[model samples]
Each structure stands twice: as structure tokens, then as C-alpha cells.
Target: FCFKILNFPAEHIMHMAIGTSLSIILVTVTNSMYAHHLNKNIDWNISKKMFFAIVIGALAGGFVSKDLAAKTLEIIFSVYVTLVSIKMLMDVKVERDPKATKDVFYWTVGFIIGFKSTILGIGGGTISIPFLTWRGLPMKKAVGISASLGIPIAMAGVASYIYNGMKISNLPEYSMGYIYLPALVGVVLTSSFFARIGAKLSHNLDQQKLKKAFAIFLMLIALKIFIG
Candidate 1:
């Protein structure tokens, strides 16, 4: 009985790691395609910076304990993200202005995205998209940038989880900290193909519609976290 219970956490960690990694790949590919066809003017520098920032934040968040404090933080982040999504949903049109996006804003947002990604086990692109679109980036650009940003977030989060798991005593077999590799694999496999599809679809849909759909999705996820 003790052995069985101990094995449970390992299984969960495997699942999470696999799910998140695949999610990162799928989202990245989707965003790349969307940006290519929809937004001709791509700023690779900004995308790179956002990606690193997300990684750092995710690493930090992943190492933290999953205790009350962590849970509280997660709740706060979920509420904040949900509100932002709702606000974006209310806006019918996104004003596009490349000049309006500042370096400071990107970094700040990247940090938030990274932290959220690690704690929530989600791609920061979900939040980054709305914020970037509101700041004047085209939806395509925002999605692309957000998708790029997820790479670092996943890398950092996964690494940290593995590191932490190694240090802790009595971890289950196949355990790698907070991540569940098996679930991670499952999610990644399923989501990657769909993410590519999503990216392709983004080209056919208007920015407003995409924003609305994304916002609703974010809200639902946030709600689930809150309930959990």
C-alpha cells in the first residue's frame, strides 16, 4: 500500500511533463505559421527576449512548494488572468500599432507570463496574446510572439521540476519533481497537432474573433484552477 501510494506522484509528474512539453511544441508551431502569413513584420528580438524571461520565471515558480503559499499564488494569478481575458473579450477591435509596444512592457509581461506558466503548467501565450494585442500588436504578431515565449517557459519549468524532484528524498519511480511525464506526453501528442491546426485557422479568422475565442478558453481554464 505504501509503495502504491508513493508511485502515484511519480505517475502524475510524468504526465504533467509530457503534457506541457507537447503543448509548448504545438503552440510554437501554430504561432509560427500564423505570424508568417498574417503578420509580415516580425520582430525576432522581442520574441527571443520574451521567451527567455518566461523560462526564468517558470523555473522560479516550479521550484516553489505546492503548499498553501503556492496555491494562493496560483489563485491570484488565475483571477488576474481571467480578468484580463474578460477585458479583452469586451473589446470588439484590437488597435494595431507596432510603435506602442515598448521593451519594458514586453519584459514585464514576460516575467508575469513565465511565473504563471510554471505555476499553472500552461503556456504564457494565453495571457501574452491579449496583452500584446491590446498594446497595438496585430493578433498574428501577438500569437506568434506569445507562442515563441512558451518555449522558454516550458524548458525552465520542466528543468526545475526535474531538479527539485531529484533533491527530494523518497520520490516515486519515474518522478521528476512537479511534472508528471506520462501526462505530459499524452497532452503534447494530442495538443501539438491541434495547435498547428489552431495556427492555421488563425489566418482565416479575424483578430477580434480569435481574441474572443482565446479569452473564453483562458477564462474556462482559470475557472478550473480556481475550483481545483
Candidate 2:
């Protein structure tokens, strides 16, 4: 929404992003449940570990983001999203029944991902999937776990953006804090169904093929954001 769909300023766009994130919970939940029932590979334990850290990080990021320069935030966002592209391009092997690294390691990763995700108004999958894979999770399970953890990021972003945006008196119409009602409604109506399809495809396809596709997709997004 930089220069393409909308022309809102960075901070305001972040609020819009947080609002859009609210619908992602549906997609993530659907993804997790399907993965658990059909694939039997959902990592609820690691998801639990990441939840607390993400909430705290997202809450803090809302405030910290206001102090950051837009250009700086853009650079940070571009750099991290691109990590997924690079990691996937490398074709890293997926570990079977891999044990999660350590609590401290995940906690650290969770916080950083949460902070950046909130500030950038992202869903966190780009960071979450890559991190999970880096620590040995198979691609399918990594996608499920990443989707599971998206709930906390969305919840925290919604609350944070709502709270932070309340103090500003100059926001546009049909607005609650920073979230635009029209966009939220539109996203909520459609994102879940597509997300479910995406989850299903992730399971049915060859992971190597998935990696190549996902890598290219992320690269395009990073370039788009960076160019804007």
C-alpha cells in the first residue's frame, strides 16, 4: 500500500496493517487445525513458547515504531523478509521429527520477529517459517507452526494499534484507531478461505518445489516494499 494501492504515510499504514492482521487469525487457525488432523505435524509446543514473547514484543514495538524513521523501518522490513527468500533458495534440508532448538533461542527469535512484524504490519509467516526451518523443522510442519504463532502477532497488533491510534485525533473516517473499516472488512471476508487453500497446497506439493515458489514470491514482495 505504499505507492500502489494506497498512499498513506508509513505510521498510518502500519495501523492499517495491524487491522488487516486481525483476519489472519482465522487463516492460521484453519491451517493449524487441518495440519493437526490430517498431517499430524503441528508443533503446538513451540507455538506456546513463542506466544508470550510475541505479545510482549508486539506491544513494545507499537510504541518504539513511532520513534523510528520511515526509511529505517523500510530497510529493516526489506532485509528480514528477504531472509526467507535466501534461506529457501539455498534448499536447506528438512529434518524429520526435529526437536526445537532451545527455549532461550526461540524466545529470542519470537521477540525479534514479533517486534519487526508489528512495526512493519506483517503477518510474521515470512520470518516464522524461515526461523523454524533454520532450527530443523520440516517444511510442512514449519508452515503449520508458523501459521499457529501468527495468532499472537495478530492479536497483539490489533490491541496495540487500537490503543496507540486512539490518542490521535486527525485520523480518517471509518477508522478505529489506525484500522480502516473497509479494508478490514474486505480482508476478513476473503483471507481465511485463501489461507486454507494455501495450507492444503503446502501439504500436497513437493516441499522442494514449494521452497522455490515461496522464495521467488518473497523476493518480489521485498523488492516491492524496498522500491516503494
**Top of the candidates by lDDT:** 2
Candidate 1 residue lDDT tens string, 1-228: 122344454334333433345345544455454545465534577787676666677766776534325346556667867987888788767466656566777778888888776766666766787687677777777777766666677677667666665665655454455444554566566766676677666678776776788789889868876775
Which run of 10 residues does model 2 get worst, by summed lDDT?
Answer: 18-27
Off by over 4 Å in 1: 1-42, 65-74, 100-102, 168-173, 222-228
Q: What TM-score goes with each of the models?
A: 0.72, 0.82
lDDT of every model, 2 decimals: 0.63, 0.72
Model 1: per-residue Cα lDDT at residue 109: 83
Q: What is the clash count of model 1?
A: 19
Of candidate 1, the 10-residue stretch with the lowest lDDT total is 10-19
Query: Please, what are the lDDT tens digits per residue for candidate 2 over residues 53-127?
Result: 988887788778766665776677678769868877986574655554879888988998788778877767777
